[model samples]
Target chain A: MSSSANHAVSYPRFLVRLLSVATDGGLQFYAWMTFLTAIALVGANAWAHQVADGMVLTHMTDHVSWGLYIANFTFGVGLAAGGVMMVIPAYLYDDHAMHDVVIFGEILAIAAIVVCIGFVGVDIGRPDRIWHMIPGVGRFNWPMSMLTWDVLVLNGYLVLNLHIVGYLLYHRFTGRKPNKRWYMPFVMASIVWAISIHTVTAFLYAGLGGRPFWNSALLAPRFLASAFVSGPAFIVLLLLAMRWLSDLKIGAGPIRTLVSILRVTTVVNLFMLASEVFVEFYTGGSHTAAAQYLFFGLEGHNDLVPWMWTSIVFNVVAAGIFLTRKGIEDNRFLVAACVLTFMGVWIEKGMGLIIPGFIPSTLHEIVEYAPSLVEWKVTAGIWALGGLVLTVGVKCGVAVLSGHERLVKG
Target chain B: MSDSADGVSRRTLLKAAGATLGAAAFAQALAPLASWAEGMSSEDFLATHYKELDAEGLKTALKRIEEDTKKKTGVDVHVTADAPIPGVKFGYALNLSICIGCRKCAEACHEENNHDRKTNNSYIRVFEMDKGSIDFAKGTVDYAHPVPQPDKFYMPVQCQQCDNAPCVSVCPVEATWKEADGIVVVDYDWCIGCRYCEAACPYHARRFNWQAPEVPAKEINPDQGYLSNRLRPQGVMEKCHFCLHRTRKGKLPACLEACPTGARVFGNLLDPDSEIRWVLANKRVFVLKEELGTKPSFFYFFDE
Candidate 1:
């Protein structure tokens, strides 16, 4: 290669060339996808008018006050929490191999927060009134309310993480090395913030006095453990997908290391879950009745029992898959294990977490709630929206970091 | 070039003239309220957590309440500055054994709180459960049909106003707090409406106003309590106040008045001869979710 070609290979000049290439077709694809998603969101907003007329437009009734929107919110939060896997490796473990992947995880976190907030807006009858939550303008301080603290912590963490990551990415794109001094403090904060977001969310339900199943002191720990397992599982799947689509490689060694971490976290998650089950059954208190209903299905409310058992089976299977040599080594098997862990966690957290909480309510009543079709569509639409965000975020992140249009160009 | 320059000059002049007039009009609007503006000192309006308010702050707040009531509703409402209930504070006792599940209490609560007429939001929920089933797992609280279904008994649950209210402890802003009177009150103006209190309450006592409540003016109760019945903004949490406005004035709760069977009992627990104390002393009273250790002021009796 000539001297000029070597100069072009330098990170700054390389990024400039990448930018030139991006403007040709890659930028157009990103813009088009964004515009299309924006249009779809507008359509969703119109449908939301019907939801405002009353959840009557949707299939939600008194029995199922929460449906697709809440489930999507739950899933989105899980995805957001998944950012920690990338953070832990790059920051806590000081693994340079995962550094290139960390920025993408931050982008994913931003996308997940958007989806989570969007789903909440759709779930409520009045999205416009969401501003009442803004402090000072409309009574913003409620220390007594876990929901209030949750709102504070989640939004705070989201902004802090996004700013820190975005700052680093921007500097990289501009060919200037970001101040390394800032990175350490931010990395440490990210670790703590990661745990805070998921724990606060778990407390949102666990703090409820009436719902015995959710009110357990184990809720926060269980949430963290599940988040640790599910988050890394998602990152592995994403890395595999990227490798298949492009020349990007998340190295075999780091992948195995992540799998090992996943194995440990999954074991912890299952142990916490088992401990919860044991306490509920053995103590045999007022909460025992709700526990029995969840595990054994009392009085024909067995719909959740089958799902819960399946979730346990899948979790165990996924754990075993990640633990074995062939399972961690084979990319396809790793992907399969990751997918199973994702679904198992979803079922355990979403269905098993929420439904059983309300089963034996404070008044000691079993309210059977099933999501309707409209609820399902709205939910699918939101998930699609989250995927679109991730796609654009990943594209931008890769373009900035790799200094190559080929990685991001449509 | 000269013609374009002239046109630009004209536009700039017009914009400048418009801006001057707008500023003048704004100033004129402010001039009339300049004297009263001193009373509206921004420093005086600093939002404080519920527990942080001092006696002087409370007095000022009470005065502000009276003024606001007079200004907004055109009613001279008496704003009480009394302390919360003493030791034998107000207690609620319900005879679930005799509650026919008429839903009259729900209706009364809706009216008393000035809830949206269309939604008819109520604080109280009466769960009808099958007889001989102690399992809450089998009970269905969400019923489409009307009251008193055959082979079922009714249990009405609302804000227990517990001694150790979880909702009071979790608020980041201290917007909700328990008064000495044993009533859990929320500062509507200070509440961020994050629905944290709703999630924290074990009894599911808290309700969020997702939209600005729309009660008909005529239907609006003129006798408003600052913490209880004034129109709440959207997104903030509200719950049963034990009809604080009426109860504070030595009146019965609207739900108590509406119950035909006289199943609902409300009285000062301090008074030994009070009906609530009598019920507590004699009846087989039970508090919901006792294991949570909330020390609920509300109790249920079997009437046997």
Candidate 2:
């Protein structure tokens, strides 16, 4: 027999052979889940302590009222926003090469949403009373409260997208083609929903007149641009990991296409960021004080400068990596580039977005803020929880697709 | 038995039973309203956000207020109807030059409105600017230490209660609204703890209760105004109300009374002889951030 023919037969039996390997992998997965749960429990306990003691337990003082929780929330939002780039190809362009990988994107979205929600819970002093936000019973609907809509859209989108993705995977495992007609509508809805979630979140910051750094017309667009670049970079990095670990081949053609898209999106994001900087400095208005504090460090609070400069450098480097042939083609280089891009976007979207908004605050006071250890550990727990969710989701998806388990076990 | 006496007794018994039933039903219907009315004074009775109470509830509340006012202040204060401006709705004004920066306003505000003592957060920020710099652009309101620096003059800026208030416009849920009497009030229960209003207010007038306010019952200022100083739920936004309970009832704001310089003035702009109107017409009054077109009711002036 020809070597190619032999490989084809063996590949079909790959899952059967890998079933033994999965047993060991399952043990690892359980261990990881247990570790994550323990961390989450500890974090939750600490959070309860914070609630009992008030925000005094947090290192966050009036000057730096918003700290790690907000930063993590912003980072999670950015990560969630990144799902759009992955969706665009599968839904809009109908790229078949991306079909297997699309589930991973949805998994990431689910994980990101959990982290986002978790961060919000930790940030609020009275998280137990969060149900008061429900309409009709407590002040059900507040058109003036962007938070109300954000809750609705974010949770709604997360569920809808997750359901649609789950349904597709179920059918794929059952040896039945998914009813494309049903998924088509969800796909369309997801596109619009994705845009809405990020836009509304941006408005949450941009609408604030007190925080000059956040109060800009460019904010919403800037958010979208950053999401487009960062989201794709994350997906690409995951695809590389999958390529090494599994037999799933995300073709070079798709990687190149995604890289090209990232190249354009990163440019747009950079442009928007530059324009914002120019307007702040050039206008020479009362608002310039906030921008000065963010970039140059007003007074002695220069804590953010090193971090901000690093973000700028990493962003530039990531953009450079996408533009170059060597960076995008080589697997190792691609991983490094994507990792840098992810971290860069995290800093830019997290600290760069939130801290700057409050510095040279409305009162023209430079308040220095840093997150405490408890805050950091809680954030880490939330991140681990997100990863755990994504891992389980991807594992379930892969299992079903490979048809390792019988569709009709009962 | 005397037949006439028996008949009269029967009628009286029937009337007494009917009156008892009527009173019981009235009490049952007014249960929530009555509970709310327990500690509130008459001045505060009429000045609630109005949106909070239904018609029957409002009537009962108003009656309760009248009763409370007579008991507390020992004065007969009439609560009158003042229609909100057609399109203008509500606005606020403050005089920077007249402000002593003593923070009596802030303290009075804290006391009048049950606020968290640890944070000591209040809506009003008294900026002490340099004496020579009449320009607000050169003003430095945030100082690390004690106030009234040698070269400084004080400006107390609270909720501009802007005609075009950004905070009101940006609220995703309609938890906050502008009332007819030129006051911006937030529904404590309705606020989702988003801090959007805090972000939106140019004056930084709004504060979010990160934790439940820790005010002692003794310090709770039993004479509560529902909209101005009622115990707030954690996560909601709050701000200064210009002492709605007092000002609406023809009494002076606590801050105005406490001011050593008598620099503060309080009155209705509609009232021709009202001191606020007089200050606006006679003095070289200027509103903060007039360029932003927030159309603040708070005015600043210097006595020549």
- lDDT string for model 2 (B1-304, tens) is 2349887577557546745764564355335434334443444322333566777666765566545545544544344333343433222345555565788877777776767887787766777777886554556655666665667888887777777777777665555777776788776545555555665676767777766677654565656565667666554678877777766665777777777777777766676766677778888878766766677777778876
Off by over 4 Å in 2: A1-25, A59-65, A136-144, A247-249, A406-410, B1-95, B132-150, B172-174, B215-220, B230-236
Q: Highest DockQ, which number?
A: 1
Give DockQ for candidates 1 onward, in order.
0.15, 0.14
Count the clashes in each prediction. 24, 26
Give the per-residue lDDT of model 1 (tens digit) for B21-107: 645644553353344334334532454443556988767776776676566556665555345545647899999788988888998
User: Local error of candidate 2 at A297, Å?
Assistant: 0.6
* lDDT per residue as tens, model 2, A276-321: 8888898986778766776787767788888888888888888888
The RMSD (Cα, Å) of candidate 2 is: 16.1
Give the interface RMSD of candidate 1. 10.7
